[model samples]
Target: MATPPSLSPISPPSPPNTTTTAPPSSLPNNTAPPTPPVTNNSDPVADSPNGTFANLLPPPPPPRSVESLPPGTLAGLIVGVGLGALIVLIGAGIFVIFYRRRKKKLANNYSGAAPQGVDPQHWQQSVPQITVLPKPTPPPGITPHLYNSVEPPSTSTSLGSEKPSNASPSPVVAMGHSLGTFTYEDLAMATDNFTDSNLIGQGGFGYVHKGVLKDGKVVAIKQLKVGSGQGEREFQAEVDIISRVHHRHLVSLVGYCIVGVQRLLVYDFVPNDTLEFHLHGKDRPVMNWSTRMKIALGAAKGLAYLHEDCKPKIIHRDIKAANILLDESFEARLADFGLAKYSLDTDTHVSTRVMGTFGYMAPEYASSGKLTEKSDVFSFGVVLLEMITGYRPVDKIQRSLMIA
Candidate 1:
């Protein structure tokens, strides 16, 4: 019951070469074209350019089909699916980033919410309101107070084996108003009617007089010239600017009074004279290098504080030796803020009228009115060089050169 194997395909053998006497009409009997005669070693199929391997023993197998895939196709499928998942993950990450940015922008515009760090409680700011409280009514058997309607009942026990009756209302407390405001007449009387002996110093705008209050406290009172709006403006500027500044080297303004065009500025009085006096006095001893360096450092620190530390960058337009005052400890304190300007808006040099002292002005600032931080630096340099040389910037040679 054994089965037969299939045989390989073969071409028909060629006939032997011979001289034939058959008629040409008999050629129709042979349906095939005659093959070339075969010799003892002649090849039936010779090499040709069209196809050398057409006569090969077997043809190649059919191209593999996906449905009937090879044994290792699962491994390829796994790798392809993993790559597709990675691409999808990257796409999702990009979408998440854009979504977060859009959400954050929307939240910033309104009642902001979500995983953001902003506190939701302060997101909606409500307008403030002013509320008035009603006073409570009096209890039974309590008579209304005289002169002060809000006064309370005062009851005291004498401990004499009987409940003591309420004592009379405090007469002094019931008499005067609680408003402790000090009037202009009071200040004038406390200052001894503006006496000349109280005069401590005179400035460009007004005179500074020393005063002693009834409580034995000393104070400096800056009195503006009567009926001078310019002096009043300067006084107001001093109060508004220095009141907000809190610095160790800056002079502090205490309180002020504006009485019928008579402007007054009060400050914590400094005990010693200005730096210009100490450095320029004839009988005063020459300042040593250490003392000069200390003064210079103090002035530089004050300038730096004004420039960087202040909320609004303030420029001390008249930062000269005359404006630096010394206290009882010889520590430098910046004074005379009348010409100060705020430079918060720009670093560009400003054009201003020449308001500074002559030898201290920068050449460009003096010529073209271009004032900047460099102008201050130049003024400081002149003061430092003057201290080192023991000569003023407006001395004989300096005046000639400056004039030239």
Candidate 2:
């Protein structure tokens, strides 16, 4: 009987008419329900049984595209991109302009062209140019004016007693060789009335003070002691010789001032102190070997220039260490031409009054006052000895020995 029942239920299996769909909870929030693809088979059951299921689904969102965005949204995006591009272009332009301006400013601050016959690399430190002003006319019988606050002595004792024949009310001279002539009042303002605080150096010639002109130029002003006929002659000689000479190793003569008997010479300021100061100054570090060599070479070149290159040649009567000044780069500049002499071509030697530092004086010059280029060379040799041994030419130890 069980077998007969099983046979009765063996009818053809009906085709599955319905498909099951996943619950809405099973899909991600951002994911759309996947649509069943349309097929060519005309099976009613395979498609949705009623149009209700298709209606519940959105009309497959009108195929999304960029053109479908709102007008306002598209315009905002275009404007934002354009503004970003413009800002970048403006920043680039500004940087270029600033770079060019900085480059031009540096070029403008550069000093004058390098001196002739000098190594450009060695002469990197630029020497500022001195602006030579026009010579001014002077009043007759010009009364000398003191540039400092110190009260002038009575007319009888003042430098007026030794006034030069060419002296005039105007400091400027008509001579072609004269440099820029400064008024006594102008120099007084520059040197702070030649106060003791402004003194930079002191020597047999006079006292040197630092001065700054109205135009922002720095200079060394040497004021010769009054009532010394020798000093007056030295002043005249220095002005005449230095005004005509120009070389890289020589101290440049910027200008000169002659008020009454007061004689002052203006020279380019050497920032670094004199060789003597560096070598023997209290509280100063000992100069390194390299710097000493540089100074020696530069001084030699300067001395050679004076003896060989100058017209009729020159004799630096005082070639002591104190007369060798240094610049920012420690370039030696031969200064203090007060004792310099012009050697005549026809004369073998110049017989002059004994002058020069005692220890640095040559034997011939000290004995017979016979000055020559060789005398300068001899003094230079003593300076070389000082540099090598770091010994003062006339120290207390040497003086004691001489006394004994």
Please name the candidate that would achieve the greatest TM-score relative to the true structure.
2
Model 2 is weakest, by summed lDDT over 10 consecutive residues, at: 150-159
**Candidate 2: tens digits of C-alpha lDDT, residues 1-404:** 36553455578989887686656667787898888766666543347677655676555557666667898999999999999999999999999999999777556425422234434432232222333343333323555343311121111211113112323223333323436778777888899988999899997778999999999999999988876867766776676567656778999888877556677889999999899999998899988899999999999999998887654577989998999999999999999888888775566888888988888999888999888899999999989989998888778866633210
Encode model 1's per-residue lDDT on 1-404: one tens digit a residue.
Answer: 99999998887888667676554555665576666556554332454455555666466699987676676897899889999999999999999999999887665533213113323431221111212122223222434332111112211121012111123322122111111223345446556866888887786778888777666667677777765545544554464346445566777666555333345666767777777888886799888878888888877877776666553456666767777877876777787665555554345766666667788878888889776777777877877776677676776755555421
Off by over 4 Å in 1: 1-191, 227-229, 345-347, 395-404
RMSD of each: 21.2, 21.8
TM-score, cand. 1 vs. native: 0.51
The per-residue C-alpha lDDT of model 1 at residue 202 equals 85
User: Largest lDDT belongs to which candidate?
Assistant: 2
Q: TM-score each candidate.
A: 0.51, 0.58
Q: Which residue pairs show collisions in model 1? A: none
